[model samples]
Target: MELLYEEAGQPCFGLPSALATAYGGDLGFTTPCLYANFVTSIDGVVALGPEYPSSGSAISGREPADRFVMGLLRACADAVLIGAGTLRATPGHLWTPDHVCPQAAPDFAELRKKLGRAAQPQLVVVTASGDVPTEHPAVQSGATMATTANGARHLEGRLPAACTVFVAGERPVLRMTDVLAALHAHGHTTVLTEGGPHLIGSLISESLLDELFLTTSPVLAGRTDTARPGLIEGFELLPNRQAWTDLISARRRGSYLFLRYRLRSSCGLGLGLSAACRKRCPT
Candidate 1:
């Protein structure tokens, strides 16, 4: 994959000069940062249909560049966050960077080592009902399951010992504020969410998402029905408060366009917390 637009050529991608400079280089976060990644059709449909269970793969047609980009983002994260639906949709899947792009495994591992990060980013699964597939391989491997107190009760002994269950709220509903604190407490400052729509909706509604990394696949899932979910779902941010974002970077490979947008502060959920939690946690 060649860079279409980065201005300065830098030493990256195991070469003296490489296209790695085109994409953002050396991503680091001292404070808690929440970002999301998604692949969507040019028409804005993120999922194809129920017919295609894993819609992202269908949406991107399993594009190698997309996979490489996914692996790259995963490499930079301290945790890979997803909803229970995403876990259910991606059966037998592992969130580690190498799992998605094995050819880049060494490079990804080297990047993490250079960044002083753990070998693999922790897997964080958000489930309100605790209705995750306990037998799924991803769940069996060490993961952090965030749910409500009632949900935690339902999941207590069902999950593997390797999985750490965090009860983020008293009620059955989850607040992104509490979730951020819990993750921060666990030393996950750079959080990446590969949402399943509703989760993205919740994060966006709470204004907690700091940035977004979206890949536009050159295809059309021309909305045959209302079931086709977009990049955001379950909520609307228009006609009253519209969340706006600024494009930070853009790159292309094949017909796919990779774009990064930094959500404006007015449109952001700015670490809204009580002074107590703010004092106890990293914002």
Candidate 2:
């Protein structure tokens, strides 16, 4: 499918061939997944205000441009996993291009068909404390919750019978590495992580991110402390270990900047350097 974005007042479309090249990695890479890293303006703001209707207003929900980029991101993901805090704060339709089976009981037949299987491209929630309310819309949509074994049991009574909860670890906080590994084990390789800053920071700190898609908005939220929080606090990457995110695509749709980046592999460091030197040396 053709993915479109807006850049510098012009429409830019992402070519499938380009996407493949941009995302290419080691053929033996066991769990190739995609992680999303986005930042709002300087203010620590993702939404406008309490209403959380995108930009905190009804007249315009999220800037149309942002919505489009997000939709494209969702379209490309095999599964969308988010933290429980994110789900509780911004619960809405999980993904797009997928039909919403509002009714149709016994099984989410329509939703399942849209997802393409009994368990393909699942919507997953990651939680440490298992604090999610069972009545949440995300849970109601049959989204599976991934937590530790203790947390899962603690939440068993509240969770719906249809929901499948997976234990990611034995600890209290859900380890993202374990979650990703489990998802990979289940054949859900192309995972997407949409975050709430803290969660994003945690992933980055843990070196679990594979790629980043950021949509920069034109309007700046003035509250630097409350509205615009940096992606991470005290975030530092060691030399040579700095994340190598290459800008693969850029688009401008209206007042937003859509950018995509592919994370360079850290595994080939010494080997790549040695090979380069060998190529340059005299026979």
Candidate 3:
């Protein structure tokens, strides 16, 4: 992994020696904000749909550098947030810093301890339907599940003893602002969302996402009727509403290109900025 460029005025966590050496630079984040990480193929495919499992790994070809970056980001967060779809796709995976890149596990632990975080960042799953794979290993281990009232009723008594459920809203679609508020109220201030596109799209539509770390894998995932998706889905932002970005950093390892971008403020707030979402948007 090598740093090609990085912007100044970025927050610094002063990563432990081992992590810093492998990451090619220091990494940190502004507190009380949400950031998302994703790997897209050169042809702009983030997922190969439900038929393909662990689509992100397939997209990146499980590049070691990408995994290290994923682990590093997870290490810096107070919680790792994801949609139920993301959880369902990777049944064997754990949303932990070491799960993706275990080589720097001890260093990650040191960083977490120094920062006063939990042994592992809390795993948060957001699902409006609450129809996630309940028998998955990660769910059985434990996770904070946020869902709608209806979804809660559906999962009543079905979820394992380790999982705790929170009814965040009464929705056909969750506003995401409310979900962030619930997480904020719980003290998981710095969040990292390894998203399934629709979840991140909800955040972007709400103008709640602060930054994006994207790894452009040098591969092409051609779309078929299988329902491939890009970096954002569930909504579109174009001429009417746009969330443009500022490139804050860029890195490279082999054919993979790691880029960090900060989303610019939007003019059309949609159902988020206006319609009461603006006030609820987390800082």
Q: How does each model score on lDDT? A: 0.78, 0.55, 0.85
Model 2, range 133-251, lDDT digits (tens) per residue? 67876677687788887778778878777788889867777777788778877767766777756677667666777667776666656653444345554366667457666665565
Model 1: CA > 4 A from native: 2-30, 266-269, 272-283
- Pairs clashing in candidate 3? none
Of 1 and 2, the candidate ranking higher by TM-score: 1
Model 1 lDDT tens row, 71-179: 8889888999999888888877999988988977887887788766899999999988888999999889988899998888899789988989989967678987788
Off by over 4 Å in 2: 1-31, 37-39, 42-61, 98-120, 224-228, 233-241, 265-283
lDDT of 3 by residue, 176-240 (tens): 88888888888988999999899988888788888899999999989767889998998888988
Cα displacement (angstroms), candidate 3, residue 209, comes to: 0.4
Per-prediction TM-score, please? 0.87, 0.68, 0.92
Best by lDDT: 3
Query: What clash pairs does model 1 have?
Result: 207-269
